[model samples]
Target: CSTFLHKLQRKSNRKRSVVSSGELHRNRRYAINPLGHKWDHHNLTYRIVAFPNTLNRDDTRKALSIAFTKWSDVSPLTFTEVTANATADITIGFYTFNHTDCWWSPLHPCFDGLNGELAHAFLPPRGEIHFDNHEFWILGKSRFSWAQGVWLNDLVQVAAHEIGHALGLWHSRDPQSLMHPNATYTGQRNVGQDDVWGIRRLYAADKKRVCDPWASTSASANDEILHEKNCPLRCDLPLESELPPRHVPRWLKWSLRCGHKNLRTTQNRYKTSPRASRAEGL
Candidate 1:
């Protein structure tokens, strides 16, 4: 999810109008749509597996489920545990040893830092996860805060971050985001807006075109058609690239001309559209 942002930003905007020119007759391509439908209507269950050592089984399980539910709220996806020996689209597991250096972090910024890399998860199609066994996997106060910490790093914070990875989110560089490489206590209570937006974008693609027979697997096919074929207008558009991000909301716009880095500001920025500029007093 975090890595996707860097990739998605490179693509140019798509045109949605109906055109008859053969050069403009774009082929259908598969891209994740931000505003697309979710998988909740379908009878799909994402199985989450856990390997607990120090963390209580019940509380850890509860926390993992809660993390998935956060994405479920924005997505129409439903998940359930598979009790039997069955394979699933997404599988969850934990690690106690540091055989793979994925959990080791010389770059980690946590207060205790090195002892706990907190948590890590593999992207979809390769589901693997590991948590630091050295940390107190229980819910208790940390050395930093005096508050009763019901959600420790190994449990709540790590679970949330791993779940983000499992959902196809890449780590975000933004400090306030849940997908950031470092974990924070504030991120545990809720998924950050950016995390939600990223998950919604990733799975939304899976919902609409993951295996859709009508769409191209590579999204670049849209620019190469030499023959004039009557294609669905909606299909030709960048499925995931066109819509504004979930965090953008309906009322707000990204004003590059505003010269304000903050998204929330009272003064509207300059605009190309005179009417909109006038409406906002830009």
Candidate 2:
């Protein structure tokens, strides 16, 4: 992952372009590359050298394909998945502890095992995404027990965040964005306006195509697609235990006591609430 301080210098020298007010607002909500490092070409290829046992091989492939499509749909970039033998711009895999040049290695930052730090990726040109195999990874929707240190980290969500790093995006302050440092279990399968603007800022959208930066795609549609592909496990529903104690509002505490039958049901209600969707940061 790109270091926060090293790449955050303000880009005051580059000429600014006029964008839609909405897009402009979204762009301003996040951090961008100071040096503006980005892929020189539009077509990029990626190869999956390894797969996690958390999801079946086909599910893993489908999850990554959708993650790539999220970015490709709104940007000029196009991603082609190639075999391991073929040369590719990006390489992805799962690892634990000191796997090669990952965080624990002497060359890179140290990775905290299991729950603390989930994954990291290099910036553009490097194009390497590594997931911590120590953590439990989940595909779509499935029952998970957080108390057992078995909380399922959404693979597609993490893939999307790591891909942002690969595509030259730093972590965004906007928590709703796919580029946020932490993952949310709200079943956000589509890119947010903040992510769209950030990627577009790095590489302008293709001239032949027009994209809406703020359009919301149906998460249910994506879930249906995954189910149709035979990847039945869906973990999109919110887990009450997953919500940090700091985030639980006093009003929500009262609601939890009176409005809902159980913690799971309360969380499901909270997940759909507009306030929860807008809650910022990790």
The best candidate in terms of lDDT: 2
- Pairs that clash in candidate 2: 103-109, 140-234, 140-235, 141-233, 141-234, 141-235, 142-234, 142-235
Cα shift from native, residue 63, model 1 (Å): 1.5
Question: Could you estimate the TM-score for every candidate?
Answer: 0.48, 0.62
**Ten contiguous residues minimizing lDDT sum, candidate 2:** 254-263
Q: What's the residue-level lDDT of 265 in candidate 1?
A: 39
Q: What are the lDDT figures for the candidates, one per model? A: 0.44, 0.61
Runs in model 2 with CA error above 4 Å? 1-27, 103-108, 141-143, 146-149, 185-187, 206-282
- Candidate with top TM-score is 2
Q: lDDT tens digits, residues 177-229, model 2?
A: 77665545455557887787678667743121212222223344243333222
Residue 129's lDDT within candidate 1 is: 58
lDDT by residue for model 1 (1-282), tens: 223333552252243333232234522221222333233333345554656566677776777677667655544355676653777655665545543454453321222333534555555545455555545565542344247443345356566666666555555544666666554544444566555545544654222422232222222233224101111221232212122245333333322111112233324322222223334444
Q: What is the C-alpha RMSD of each candidate to the true structure, in Å?
A: 16.2, 16.9
The runs of at least 3 residues in candidate 1 whose Cα sits more than 4 Å from the true structure, single-residue gaps closed, are 1-50, 98-114, 139-154, 185-188, 205-282
The deviation in Å at residue 62 for candidate 2 is 0.9
